[model samples]
Target: MDLLPRKGITDDEIGGQVARIIELATLEEKIAMMSGHGFFEQIRESGGRLSAHPYRAGGGCERLTVPALYFTDGPRGVARGNSTCFPCTMARGAAFDVDLERRIGEVMGIEARAQGCNFSGAVCVNLLRHPAWGRAQETYGEDPWHLGEMGAALATGIQAHNVVATVKHFALNSIENARFKIDVRIDPRTLREVYLPHFKRILDAGCASVMSAYNKMNGEYCGQNRELLTDILRGEWGFDGFVHSDWVLGVYRAYAAAAGLDVENPEPIHFGAELLAAVKSGAIEPQVIDTACRRILTTLYRFASAEDPLDNYSIDLVASPAHRAIAHEAALKSAVMLKNHGALPFDKIEVRLVAVAGRLAIIANTGDNGSSRVWPPYVVTALDGLKDYLGDAKVVFAGDEGDSDAAAETAKAADAAVVVVGYTARDEGEFIPGDMSGDVRVEVPQKSIGGDRDNLGLSPDQIALIKTIAAANPRTVVIVIAGSPVLMNEWIDDVPAVMQTFYAGMEGGRALAKLLFGEVSPSGKLPFTVPASASDLPFFDRDAESIEYGPYHGYTLLEKSGIRPAFAFGYGQSYARFGYRALKARRSRAGIVVSVSVINLGEVAADEIVQIYVGFPGRMVDRPKKLLRGFKRVSLIPGETATLRFEVPLDSLRWYDASAKSWRLEPGTHTIYAGSSSRDDDLLRREITL
Candidate 1:
């Protein structure tokens, strides 16, 4: 029998087949899809490659259907062998350009298909619940709207390949320590407003699958929670794709299948036996089993396999040099310029002293741990990039304590110092299982991840080294390397300049080589705010009183608490200056459209992201200080003027009014802002009197 059915198969045919399958299933067969087969250990390293065995050979098998489904992990980067390892999501998120994300996703999707694995089972858009959460670096950052926008772009990019792109863990799977069993207590208002948006966006983007969470929400297991699986996921968003359990999310086969899940992933326990068992026991209706089977089969068919109805999987364009160029470009744009005391644009460096600090100054400079910790043969570090670009300018190198006395000695000898500092692979990404195989090996998490980070600030050693270097050298530029936002309390005030280069991917070193020599202008923006101190907001760890236990922190609540961040979202600086003026906003029948004149006021060329935010003031429902409904990234040369337009569907301003349980739009004056950053005090707005 054909396992993969074409789309829109006759309703009668679908109904009939489901009925026949239901009638044929034994209780054991019905129970098969409930749970899966798993590897004996977390991971197995063989012949210089990693393989995840979801099933054991003796695992129960089912007779019906085609070959069993096999899948691998990833979103920020592909995990299948034979693909180029991209940078982590934290680094990608910093690019602040949605187009860049789409391009990067395309590259990832192409590479995954080329590597011979079906697409990533999940995009693991891990939301940032707490800064200290080990997996927080795997997320886009701490903002729901921003994560949603970027995640949506990527989801659409990858799933477009006919391979599934799974938007993961459903809700708050951020805290890794107590993830599996902890009851994540949260208020429904925040749940609908923030935590749910990214998942919703990914689903809306046509992702074919979703992974249930390992943790519980409001006194229930995530996989078993009907409210999330049925109510919000299916009820509210109208998601028609199949839902799979995260590794080990299922404890019972019949219960999970009856609970609205389609398949148990990784290891398909009992093979197809569980579904057959459910059928015989009468615990699950036959049609339900058939429907689940049909969904699974249909999904499997979408793959570029023998069963696939879509175009054959052949060469993947995403892995081509053209695509890596996209990643190279994004890795560059995601960079944020924190402090620029004219040590920027490095437009004039004819034979100046250049001293590089930290391991990231050259190759293998990226975060060393996690799924994205690529085993590529080559890498580009900032140090090597600088030396290569500076030509005859002798550049000094020193391993400054991550702040040691040795740092001071080196600083005293340079014409200028570019201190490269950031966490290494040890402190970030998916947890490494540790090599028990005799040879020294770094273990990485299989499926679920939780390794990295002991504190929120840089090591005292690095801070001390920074202070010494800053005091000794008048011109010190600290270049931060890492994937996520780090706390900058002790030494930020003393640095004359600072630049952040997230784990730059393949062409990373070469990109930095270009940026340093005035080859490319700096245009990356911050997706998340930098807190004045780690304590400026709620604890990065989910303390009993923090938002993780209830309502989470965002601009909306931050304002209520009267706490200000060191930097606001969408914030970035350019080599050239730009001016915003003459806001022309007109409320139309369709929605609200705003236009503004952005003029490049400096000598250098630059691209500016025109961000539009809508605020529902005095909102009865808890709302963000503003919601990013739309934005446009445009480029211009000096003295060039570009008029950018952004339109917000009236629905963008609507909220889930708890009282009515429907989307709400208050008939009040709506304020809109068109500016460079979320907290732009410089430009245009108009009140839409509805």
Candidate 2:
């Protein structure tokens, strides 16, 4: 009775068993397990729709009794039927609450498992190189440190339940439109310091897998780039997990196996028979195939054996009330109050007649329906939330169908006008074919479905509507519903108050109602810098097949060019005021500890994002004005004070030296700036030598 080979064992006992199982596995079984078998066929059978039903993507060996890995897309929520849709990753990043993100990860893991998915492809840490990057909403932010910390929290949370977490778009795969064809030529320093740090952080957290980017890095496809897949990821960083290709058109050549890609996902377009032929023709070694299979099998066994397999879970856990509450909490925390001129916290009795303008107010506007789509039981619209909250108070709605003048005339009678505006799935998301192709080689049905935005401004009609409403009603609050930053130069001055509620999850509307009525304070900060003008940011060409990536973007570029941002990164305001005082920095064994007392000065309770930036001494090479090293979100009640201590890791402060191809922390008098945002003048600084 050698039961070790049949029954599922614990993760600790999988090391020796993995080799034994691999030895028992034949060449066909190993190759079959290396890539996703019949993956695209399953999607095609399902009409290219994602559902709760399990679609085995990889790692099932009948001979070895290895369970298949059921994977799904994520970051917001599980990408399946009737799943709880949390706020977008950008929204979570704005919250700056790592603990909350971990909670989200835990719930995501539960739901993903409930949906019969054991592998979650959710940890999207691709840096937001530009705000216009269509899939900007999927990632955390532009800063490497912020993305790393946030992604690490998410990866850690997902793996807690024994679900495999996949950190994606391995190298620089920011651009959306030309992702399949673009060559991002970046300097070694920029690639190491900015582009790749977040992925490394996720790997350090022991993410189960890495999804190679579709784009080419320095003229080589990421899936087939040995320097990226083998040298950096596997060799240098010691990522032992299997590396999979992006869905559909991830790899173009079968020899990608030689490049260190362990799995070809969704389908075996480039793998399967082509890969078999290569191996038989001496183009690839059988040992390489064995290595790939072993990696995949080992990782799968580690996760599958750690807990009961996901297929046994009930579907009721997908969008449970508790899970929806997390969505509400995310929405509450993700809202960034851009401007408030005594117009927010709508008094129930005082503000009787409220006009909720724009079509977005009534729509169930979650986000893109590409890969991260979550079909909640019901979506709470802004109108629904307001109506639910303001029971006796009259909340009027002015649809976009009517004439602008008529809408404005109606708004004049209201005590205050709240206009909901901004983009949806039509404007941004994961770039896919208009036809939703099973194969990417086929031409896109139409123009870019999900690609980099051509512009960063609101629609002219929306601008006109806001201006009209502002002129009619002295009290007007503009709420922007977008995934990323939007330039507000056109009509920012017209509106009295402005809020950026990124595609907040299923309960976003309810959360919006709470923030508007002062039930909860607006606590979310800007994850990316809002440029005063789009021209101030880096050059972005979404359709360009090849481009050069610079070391600086977002706030770094704006600061370097001496251009002021419309709203700096990590900037957000609450209903109440917070004062930062008693700032001190001292070196500790862990690293430099920067402690500051944050006191809520206003009568209302609120939350504050304490951001710590290290101003590296200008010397050997050009550096960012200041880099975000650490941040924490602290909640405070009225008149309450808390001492926030942020540990400044010396390793994070190190700059990548191109000559040595290693990170070097220069010893100098570094200025530690503590503030609510990245604005230089707003920060309280103390000089310290490291």
Q: Quick one: best lDDT, which candidate?
A: 2
What TM-score would every model get versus the actual structure? 0.88, 0.96
Backbone clashes for every candidate come to: 41, 0
* Model 1, position 485: C-alpha lDDT score: 65
The collision pairs in model 2 are none
Query: lDDT scores for all predictions?
Result: 0.65, 0.85
Across 1-690, the per-residue lDDT of candidate 1 in tens digits comes to 443335555655555544555456554554454334443243543422443322321112255453345455664466554445456677777766777777666666666566555546537676675566667656787777678888888877776665567788777777665555567778666677667877887777777788887777887777767788888887888887678776543433445666667766545552255556656778667767656666654455544332333355455543556766676787667677777877665545542767777655654755545444444435656766676667535766856674456767787788777777777656665553434222223254334233646676777777777788888877777877766667887788998777777777666766775765567777777766676666665554432222245564645555556677777767777788889898877889988878888999988887887777777665455555566776778889999999887777786677666666677777877788888877747446767776
**Candidate 2 positional error at 605, Å:** 0.8
- Local lDDT at 45 for model 1: 39
For residue 264, model 1's alpha carbon misses the true position, in angstroms, by 1.9
